[model samples]
Target chain A: MKKLNFGIISYAHPHALRYASTIAQSRRAKLCAISGDGANSDVAKGEAKKYGAKFYKNYEDLLKNKNVEAVYIAIETYRHKEVAIRAAEEGKHILLEKPIALTLEDADEVIKAAEKNDVKLMLPFNPRFTEPLIKAKGMIKAGEIGALEYIHAISENVKPPIFLQGLDMSWFLDINKSGGGGFMDTAPHGIDSLLWLTKSVPKKVFADIGAKIYGFPVDDIGTAVLEFKNGILAVLTAGWGNPKGYSYGLEIKYYLVGREGFLDVRTAYPDFTVYQDRAEKIYWDRPDVRGIVGSFVTAVLKDKDVPISGEDAKKNLAIILAAYESSRKGKVVHIDL
Target chain B: MKELKIGVVGCGNIFNLAHKPALKNIESIKVIACADIDGERAREGAKAFNAKAFQSLDEFLDLDFDVVEVLTPTYAHAEIAIKALKAGKHVIVEKPIALTTEEAEKMVQTAEKEELKLFVGHVRRFDKRWVQMKDVIRKRNILPMHIRKREVQNLPFPAHYWYWDENKSGGVALDLGVHVTDFLRWFFESEPLEVLGTGKAIKEEAKSNDTFDHFIMVVKFEGGKTGIAEVSWAYPYPSRYGVFYHHVDIIGKNGRIRYTPLDTPVVGVAKANFEMPRFSPLLSTFPDAFERELRHFFECIKKDIEPKVTAEDALIALEIAEKAKESARKGEVVRL
Candidate 1:
């Protein structure tokens, strides 16, 4: 298999390293070059060196590399727009992290730029590709659980020390930088899972949320009840409330109620759990990161649909954004998507 | 020790399983008399507990008793409770203090006027694990809790009990949702601000309307804390998993507590199809929740103290539940 070359945009985000590492591990995907933020260039350089990828001071310079066939937009939430648009415009296949952009308009720009450049865009919703959830998807489709009537998903984290490596408490707390609070940050995985399992978009969203934990400008805990097209209801809870050291060690768990059967996916404790002293490390077993990036490579190489599309990311983001709007307006906001 | 003679109205499953067993366990409380619309059921319950059997509510109310346990189908809760309260009898109506907010208020006012205790049977509060969970939540800065009450009655039940009635029993939301709704309020010690919900009625060959099999509700509490709950009676082929169960996850700023029946300590191997969790630790000894609740009820009556779940508390839960129905119907958020 001819390895498709991959490039990293920024290492400022937490999942940036995991995505870069996945590219490095893939048999069909090679980590080609990296672009680090101007302020945090050294961290990206170290990350590139550790992963055996060349570092580029300018993102555009990295995009100009013919070996960089695909770019993974692991930048901060706010810069998702500019970076994704530029990458898509460069005709490079894009695998962006969740929250494709800060706003729907920016998401639209990314979509348009990708279409104009005729590139496949994939969002690395890694958990969805986990072995258990893939089986769950097959169950729903195979009618093992019949029609999905309701789904309750939770993805909360206490921000393990590893997650806060180069970042501080205020880094993700700033609305200007992160766009939203705990729910927005932790909710994407659950939101995407609900969207994918049911294979339906939300019709309305009613979110009861607050910034109670950190008392920051953004909400730290919340639940968004999404009503999908066929009277299906899903409750998505994503927060930074569950402390790192807890009995229920994993921060992510999903439960689905269907007409024929029931399905539960504990993302944090997805596969297994282990205890070492006071810290209970939950190995929410997932496919190798390469499986996600490799899917992107396979999609680009075969001219097939990516595992996670920009449209799917847009819908999930819309559900979450509507949740925020509902929280602020104190009402159930209808989802046009 | 003075014994409080308790008269029971409406001979139902909860009366036989929950109250009778628990009240019988306590020494200070004696089951004196029982009444039901059906004379045979009343006779059956009264005989086992060494209590007298009355033919009707009026006859039962005419007798002397300190308290009355209204175990009728939920539709009759307010009516029976109001009559018992006006007669100067303490009321322990089963969960869902009343069918509507108005009835709940009337019951509350009547109890206040009569200077009698009105305890609503939100029995899950008595679960030692749940009590411990709430205590931990209070001591810790718990953020949000997700509760699920899934009854694997997925294959259409015969609708034998009044609970299957859409109009009177209030389906799964009011019947089951009320428990967690009250628990959430008790846990937060706050009033509800808003409620948004969505539910579905499973299609089956039945009378009137299909049983409301599924419901997902979210409630906003006063102190920025929130609760999300899903109550369902439908999840077909339940034996493929296990029996009915209640699960809860309490997420906090530092830690979390999860009670899942499926997360059993032991695992059981079955047919080649799959392996299922053997038995939930909580469900293994499920009667304790009701036993503790009944003990608390007896203690409150004897000590002349207010119960944890007051009529007002149940009223608030019902209020939120009612709004949830409205939210589901209106396809919009309903403020409490």
Candidate 2:
């Protein structure tokens, strides 16, 4: 199979570097171009150079490049809709970093642009790529853990100064740009993870959003209590200001208590540790651990739906947006999607 | 002197605490073999204790051993113990024998058929304070009892470790809650009639294998006796103090007893007239309790008297833990 040529439009998102590196190392994709604003373009250019790719000062220039068949948007949350629309218009496939957009309208705009252009749009919810998470989803689907009763999924980052800086990004801090703060920035991962693991969409959501810390204009902490279609209750808490020096961590715990027994899949981190309740030794050191970039490349090359598809990603965004709306209204919001 | 052959399965944090220390103390129990899917961890465990390591349970089970400690995660308790029992070896399993009542029944049945002694290590049952408390409860008609176990420290291991995995460790209820559950069931002498619980994970960026670090469970026993057990892995306190230190309250028909076992001693001189708060006497009953349980296991193997805390009993505790989790999830009363 021909290696698909790819371009990254922004290097400002902390995950941009990882996305770039992952694309560079992909067996099925080639790093072709990078585009970003003036201040970050230099760094993006340098990063692109390391990958032996061309760097463009503008999104149009990158899109015009004939070699770039697909564009991976790692820009600030606000730029997602505009850049994604432009990429889709140019007949390029897109792997958009999460949130899809700040609002339901903007998210729909991007989705529509992809539909209009007839291009595959992928939203990279990275947690779905982690082996433990994938295995947990499989187990739940296979009924290995029995019928799902409850899911408590949490992802907390050590609120280090560096991560706080990511939140401090003008666009990230602005509700108009970032949609909301930590809830919009990070909670989608948890939402997507729960939905994927349970294979159930939330029917109603009761959420509380506030600036527990960071003292930013937007909420840095939010909790969403979701009722899924299968009568499963899920609680997801996403926050910043966790002690730093730790990578982005996520835990998806499912309780499938039935007549026979219960099964638990405790994933400690993205990298290692898949624990069962009764096992003595934690299954650690997963060398073939799949991350989002690999999954994207494989999905595009294999013509398979990305483990977290654009639709799935949008549904998760709807849940987050609904959570925000519920928090704002101080009542339970029924999820339409 | 020939070393006592010992094989351990389940390479988790508990192995380091229970089996590791116990084996180091007993020169006779030579840890000859170890098994874990994490080959490196199994090797490290074997290296730490000077034993051979195997990545698969089959290979580990093939080895000749007088005793096998099933340290694998809690979900595998029934399968591993039953296999070890059928293999005709004395088995020591970690708490809450299985994830459900039926699984525990199968284990007991297998142990009975094989004529092997099965020891469920409710380690706190081996704690001195608990032993004293058990003695007290045995003698009195205790009413409402409260036991709180907290694990607030940043877990020494990642949340993805098997025990934190709901499938492996059965969440906080089966993993950590089971200890207090077993203690409560043994103390109350009755199966829980109903359970109510609630739990939430405070950390959002925690790993995928993690669950709610905070769990509060209220259990009502058959005879109008009720107990509450609250446990957490991310409670923001020191881990050792949370596990080793406990505040217990027993309200009886006649009198009430409040004790904080493993309390930090306060020593200071008063400038004028100051009264010292009375301190509970330092009780070093752990060694006795450990020796008693171990001797009982050995005796059960020889004399064939029913084990003190049978696998069936541990299963009952697990059933309570499961019901508590169900109640927590559903936010409704779970009738056991």
Candidate 3:
């Protein structure tokens, strides 16, 4: 079996390390090269040395390398369209981070490039990879609960990349660079999972978004109610408002209702907490990151459709943008997509 | 320590489950009479309290009770409380002072002109958790910037009940909405400037009523604070009661406070007694807030002081809820 040789573009987003580590340990994937271009270049260089992979000072140089068959692009959000398009044109299968681009036009261009170049464009929506939610999706598909009618999902975190990654994540709070704050960063997970689980398109969105914590220019709290074409009413609350002492720093939960039965799902389930005098310790009972990267690697190797495509992510981004518009205009914004 | 003679009107679910049990625990108050549109429940309630029973408020108001606790349906609150106040009785009314602000104002004015004490049952104000939250915010100067609260329950009544009728009961936006809106106004200590809302019925039983059993309302307060209230009566379907869940998160300038179902330790699995509030079924407990609320009402009547929850405060919450309903209906924000 030939291992898929992978190059990682920029270590700006924290998920870079997860993908790199997964490739390092996998039997079917190889960490062929690492690239850097911005303030995170040194970090990228250090990661390359630690992983014993070739290092490229610029991502284009990495793309120029003939042996790199695939790339996981973890650059900042504003640069997603540019880097993804470049990766696609390089004939490399790409795993793109979420919020595909800042606008629908940019997202469309990236999708067009991927389709034109015949490359698989997958968005790393981690929830789609988690075990419990995967099982929930299977149950919904099997009609375990009758026809799905309503869902209330919440995705919350302790601020952003800073608390989770211990890095300066001020870029995520900048409206111009990241597009929006907590909702923009976190709601994509819930929105994507909702769309996937219900297999429905959104018809309207009404939201109330604001800077509720830290008084940052970008909003820290957002709540949106969406009506789906299938008559599913989904309410999503995404925020960076968890206090310091919460056990699960990243908590995602869902309340699913159907005609016959209901489901209360905690995405961060099968975890344990240890309380000691010095500090509290929390551990995920099973590894959740494995499937996200492994499945993408296998999809590229098998020449099969990726689990979540660029078009699916574009719809997620469209809903997010509609929520912002709804918040701004203080009206329910009808989503055509 | 004198015994305060109290007359309770509208012998319904709340009176039987919350007020009767709580009033029995209070040694300083005695129920002198009970009245209801349903004479059977009124007689049953009188028997439970060892009081007289009457089929009409006109007949009941003539009794020699010092205060009247109006626990009738929300639409009847203003007329009943005003009538009680005019009869020279200090009044204690269940929340949402009236269906409309005009009616709430008339209740307030009548109480003022009659020179009698009027207290509204905004029970969360007396709950220790919320009071402590207020203390933390004020004492620590948390300076709340955004507050989120959600209260959800299975449908407490049958499909044919007034609760399913939007015009009769005002749906969840006015029913459960008032409970949380009152909390938001109290927590922020500022008037709400605008409200944006989205709501739906969601249940097939409510599909014909043209009412929302679930609603999410976003309120912007005067001091640049934000409050979100997501209230629902559409918890688990099939009209099973006794499922209750609530969450509160207060994000402020200096600190954050949150409470979720995970924090609660009590759990029960049963048929979920349909007669009680959703909490009473699973939690197997009624909040002691009811007793504290009754005690405070008695104190206000005795001390001749304003209540912890006043008619004006209730009126403000009702106004916010009404605006929220309008926002949900028009699909736009409604300004105060």
How far out, in Å, is residue B108 in model 1?
2.3
lDDT (10s digit) by residue, model 3, range A1-337: 8899999998877778778888888899999899986547777888999999999998999999999999998888999999999999999999898889999999999999999999989998777677667767777788766787778788887766546544446778778778999889899998988898778888988887888677788998888888898878888888787655666567777777765556667745455567675233354433556786788888998988888899999999999999999988877899997
Better model by lDDT, 1 or 2? Answer: 1
Each model's DockQ score: 0.41, 0.02, 0.35
Q: Which residue window of length 10 is worst by lDDT in model 1 chain A?
A: A160-169
Chain B TM-score (model 3 vs. true structure): 0.92
The local lDDT score (0 to 100) that residue B76 gets in candidate 2 is: 82
What docking tier does model 3 reach?
Answer: acceptable
Off by over 4 Å in 1: A160-162, A167-170, A247-250, A268-277, A280-288, B139-157, B203-211, B237-242, B264-285
* 1 versus 2: better DockQ goes to: 1
Best by lDDT: 3
User: What's the lDDT of the predicted structure labeled candidate 3?
Assistant: 0.82
Candidate 2 vs candidate 3: the DockQ winner is 3
For candidate 1, what is the DockQ-based docking class? acceptable
Q: On a 0 to 1 DockQ scale, where is model 2?
A: 0.02
Model 2 misplaced stretches (Cα beyond 4 Å): A164-170, A245-291, A302-304, B1-336
Tell me model 2's lDDT, rounded to 2 decimals: 0.66
